[model samples]
Target: MALIGRISLDVVARPQEPTAKKRCLDEPQPDTLKRAKFSDEDYDANKRLRKFQESWKVTYPWVTHEAYDDDQKPGLMFCATCRAYPDLADKSSALYVGCSNMRVDPLKKHEFSSAHIKATNKKTKDTMTMKERSELATNSPIVKATKRCMQITMNILVVMFNTVYSLAKKCKPLSDFETHMELHVKNKKDIGGDYMDIGTNYHNEKRAKEFLMSIGEQLRVTKTRLIEKVRFLTVLADGSTDSSMTEQYTVLVRYVSEGYPVTTLASIEDIENANAFGVKNGIENGLNKIGITDSSKIVSVNFDGAAVMMGCKSGVSALMKEKNPRIVLIHCVAHKLELGVLDAVRSIDYLLKFEDIVKSIYKFYARSTKRRRDLQAFADILESELLHYGDVKTVRWVASKARALRAIQQNLFATLGHLEHAASANKTEESGKAKKLLHEMKSARFVKYLHLMMDYLEIITATSKKFQQNKLLIMEVPDIIKSTTDELTLMIEEPGHQTSTFYDHYDPETGDFTDHGDHVMKLSGQRLTTYEEDNDKTTLLKQTVKYLEVRFMDFNEKPLKCFDAFNLNKWPTNDTELVKHGRDDIKELTQHYIDILTDTEHSSMLREWTIMKNLLRKKKTGINCHDLYCELLQTQPADIQNILTLVNIMVSISPSTAECERQFSAMKLIKSCRR
Candidate 1:
């Protein structure tokens, strides 16, 4: 359907000349095509300028062939200053001018001009004042727009990286955001949305890695500043294997920053082995690379109680101490506690049997798909959810043992039903294993010991968690160890704690007092023995308490005992009693450094110790010792400088190397099997 009729009005021009004769297919190229695609106006402009030889540099050394514009048919020469700052051009100055003349030696003439001399002496735009640059930048639309675009692109990259890091997500956001913007540009141009295509590099894996490295460099710079500001810090080191099975040691620096504990991950180094020599070298090289020039600044070294790390003579800590006598070595308190728990558990026979039974029940379901399915079916029939069994983490974190026990306890009824059903079925390998698991799960001894170990390890795991806290103070650690030991002692001696934990009935509705009567009744063949014969629970608790006391007794030895004096509890409130304190622990603590300190400084420290006691009594509110020292620093009291110096010594003492252990946890996430 035609909407309107077309109008036909045409006029023809008179033909004055005919087209040129057609050339043959194999004819030589036309003269017009043989010449470069220069327009007549450009040709005329170039013809007007005097051409100069390329050797003009001989007479004018500053003139270079790089100034030539190769895009022009005959090319043109430009002064370097004029090219760099094209707006500097003027009618009188040959220096601020460009020329295409074949006959005139403009370069030679321009070199001697006063304008050229002035332009050469002027600073480049990079050195220009901010105000001048801002004015110039804002006036030029192209430059301003380009800069705005570049700034926006950088902002986008920063936000993208921040989101990825903050959320602990992968690099997908980097590419995903770019892809979304690309799609929007394609489909929403009419709506005024803008996304200039920077293409694959902006969103690719290579660019993502480059940006990550750039962030690492920035963090390193910040870490360096913090380290230098603190001047002296303890080195907390630990080694762990990645998913790829490569042993990497992470070095962390612990120092007091603004009244709080500040721990920075200084470096992550891959070592040849986990031996003392290899780890020690890795640490030295890593710290050196990170700008820690003086080993003497390492006032203390802390690591786990591994033989290679804490060996008295040949360990990494010993090696460091040998190099610098001032560096005191301390083992990780949390790790030592975990080791004690492991030792206590392993020493008992019935407790080991309990652990084996729990592990066996987990494997019974975990190892067989059919068994897990059957358990799930039983859980569904009973209107409950099945719990997954946890693997025991042998890395001194006893929390996993609790999780495993809890899972079994939660699903005890359904799991037993599933096993009972399997046991009653026709004979099969699965049935046989199910019958055995059912027998153990129903044993009165197994039920009692499971509850026993679960409760005992809960205390150990809690202490572990407390030690791993980022803000825990070194002075606070001795108290924490004592309290933990006291809690274990209470757990051993107090019958109420025992009866409530191990023997009490767990109520599912109230989420307390779970009873094991029904699980014990389903025992295939085993029965409960007399109470006198079954003293496993009492024995396990006693062993745990004994081991803890032996392990934690390290706090009482030598220079470490001096740290206990620094605790505010020991600081005498009366000035008359300051010099007559309980023991001369400070002398022993600082005895090794007497040669390093001047007589005046030593006297100042003795005087400050007296004043520090008064300061503590004056500010009577409860505050952490490390925090109190930092607060005192703000007043800049001359009398407290020496006392503050002593506080720094205490602050430098690492309570534990748990942060390094946490880094390994992050390593597992970062370097996953798929990753």
Candidate 2:
């Protein structure tokens, strides 16, 4: 019975299967195979699997589920922005394709990932209009943060630069840069950011030196540009040994800038050899460094009266003149004055003796603190203020000697009292020297010579001060020399006030002393006879006058004398006198500067010279050459351009090397022994 039932069931199932199998084979086989592979139990189990949640979209806006047609299937998660811009997406990231492992961790990780953020930003940028993109970029938090960082960095750099500049300008050592930066950081805590805390390596001595060099290079470039624009310039040079015993030559350029003569230091070179050729090379190198390559642009050169600098044939000035014959070579007038005075002093025996005594007195007090205290004590006792003794410098002889003489004169009674006390106190070597100095001080001849020199130097010292003036013009030099010579000549006829006062102290006839004033000592030596005194005075005064004339004889000659025409103070007031007044001078000046002027310019200068005289005569105002030239420069008339240029050259010519001397003084301060 079971076999018969099985066969009957197989027969019934086979007929139903045939129709179903036929249908499956006729239709697509993929869906039928899928249905055959999974039963209802398996489908229910797979539908229970975890899927991308819609709630994740709240936390991660870039998250989205994979598209599905049926609700029974599990969905994959993905970053929609990353999928749209696949290049900006991470290739290994599961979210970049479709994340089947639909956990919140992967979605959260992808949302904050660099790739996802970049894709999101790119999508936002692509969708915006131009104006909208600009606004978004401007208002973005990241951009604002970046700008703030840049601003802080710039502020830090500015502070560092300013600190370096301040130290350099004050001539402080570069090693002090660390200390200065620390001070800034302490005062302004936010100045250097992390740089300040990490040590001074960022702003150390090496960095300071680099900053200083950069600053110097920039300033040099700027000055070179300014010099290249000017038509003419004057050069002043001087050489000296620094603390390291290195010979340094300082070169300065003088040019007319905005109607004022500006003397600027161009360069300070370390010269191995300080001879004529070496010094000339140094000067040319300095000028070249400042963009002054054309030797013809140099209108004048002023140097001290050293043979190597001012020699006629083989000197620096001569060499420069050989290159450009139009250049005017000037011996520093201040140096000339000093030399002239020294020559006169060397001719007189008593004056030389007087100089030795003065120097000895200075050294005696300067060397001993005890002697200085005693001198000060005696000075206080006499109720007179005394100046400290100054060394008699051989370079600036007259001025330094005058200061020393003034000190002695003010402390005359105090010095005598100190000497008398020391002489009586003991038999020490110092006391013996004091006794000898006291004997010399008490002599009538010594007192007379002291006051005589004091009076004579007072005049020369005043003249020396004028000669050292930086703005002293060549046209005014002759007048200064003439006035100084006349004042000295007047001193010869009428004795100086101090000398005449000394004569009042003692009896003229007898060789005996009278009741001396409290300021001076009673003298016991023989007084000078009137003839001897006159002869001595005549010798010093006449020799000084003669030497001054000889030393400054060039100022009275050709081109320099012709510059007098530019002296408005000496201009003739009358029209008849003015018409022909500067005609010869103009011709000579034009001929002198023929190389510097064109033929048209020469003719224009001649015509303008007369016109200028006439125009200035109409105004009749007492204006100086500099002031007149500056006013004319404001208008810059076409006809007077050549004359104006001539005046510019003249004013730019320095009368002395005082500017170079000042630079040396500054160099000494900067490169001191301790440094």
Best by lDDT: 2
The weakest ten consecutive residues by lDDT in model 1 span 1-10
TM-score for every candidate vs. truth? 0.72, 0.76
Query: Model 2: residues >4 Å from true position, as ranges?
Result: 1-171, 174-179, 189-204, 391-396, 505-520, 529-533, 618-624, 634-639
Q: Write the per-residue lDDT of candidate 2 for residues 489-521, one digit (tens) a residue.
A: 888778887777777765656544432445534
Candidate 1 differs from the real structure by a C-alpha RMSD in angstroms, to one decimal, of 17.2
Task: Give the poorly placed runs of model 1, Cα more than 4 Å off.
Answer: 1-146, 149-153, 156-201, 368-370, 380-386, 391-397, 496-534, 570-579, 593-601, 618-622, 633-638
lDDT of 2 at 580: 81
Compose the digit string of candidate 1's lDDT tens values, residues 1-675: 133222222123444578899989899997877866789888887765434576665656555443345545445556666555544434455444445454445665776666666566563465788998888878889998898888977866665466445434442334444554455445545555464333333554445556666777887887787777775688999988888888889988887776555787888899986789999999987887667978867778889888999899999989988889887778888788788788877877866777777777876776677878878888887777677754334312376676777677678778888888998889798789888888887765666566655666678778888888776666677677667767766766454343455445533233223344433332333444333454655575667778877886767776777777667766666766755663376667557555445567566775676677666765646776656766775555786776566666677678788889877877777667765
